[model samples]
Target: MGEVDPAFVQELEHRPKQGIIEAEGLPIIDLSILSSSDATPDHSQALEGLVKQVGNACRDWGFFQVINHRVSMEKREKIFNASGKFFAQPLEEKNKIRRDEKRVLGYYDAEHTKNVRDCVKKLT
Candidate 1:
């Protein structure tokens, strides 16, 4: 909750900061379809559009992203704020929440997933 420690900010300066080498815009799945009575059993009005986007993303790009899933920006900010506090803890303290390979759910690092590593690569 206090000001972020200066040394911690300095430490992040050493992490990777390269630009993305390859990139593609992903389709955004809107959650509004879930509540629409007009939607099909699979919750689709743009069902074919969603299917095409998802199919292309998986078959060609290997992954996709979602958007407009109904979380407000205010709620999203709170989540990020809580995340900052959790990540700010020292490794000894943070490791308590580290997830195991089998029970992976908690604060797992970037070393385990190529998908995340690739995204970081693309982002940086």
Candidate 2:
């Protein structure tokens, strides 16, 4: 949150930004219907429709928002807080579990776009 490195800003200036879509136009998938166990014809049809919606959303948009997922807000908040704490760690500490060719399930900081380094980080 302090002064960002000028070099980082320069890199961002040259990178293609993600397109923003209006909230109303965004794909918001409802998940409540999938929770029902009734084997009625209507339920089966609705489930099939839901599956198609998810597929289309994934194909057209890289991601889609979900609703009525049934996850409690408290659990969601805890996950967010934990992620914040993890990302807040110093670089060296994060690298202690560095992801590499030999190990595909750990921390990584560099993301490549068309083989070009794009600044990003993740722990898998």
Which candidate achieves the best TM-score against the true structure?
2
The true-versus-predicted C-alpha distance at residue 106 of model 1, in Å, is 1.9
Clashing residue pairs found in predicted model 1: 18-124, 19-124
| lDDT of predicted model 1 | 0.61
Off by over 4 Å in 1: 1-26, 39-45, 62-65, 110-124
Q: Give lDDT tens digits, candidate 1, residues 12-82.
A: 44443344213444545555554557746555546666767778767655666766677887997898779
Leading candidate by lDDT: 2
Candidate 1 contains a number of clashing pairs equal to 2
Q: Any runs in candidate 2 off by more than 4 Å, and if so which? A: 1-24, 113-124
Error of 1 at 74 (Å): 0.7
What C-alpha lDDT, on a 0 to 100 scale, does residue 17 get in candidate 1? 38
RMSD of 1: 8.6
RMSD of each: 8.6, 5.5
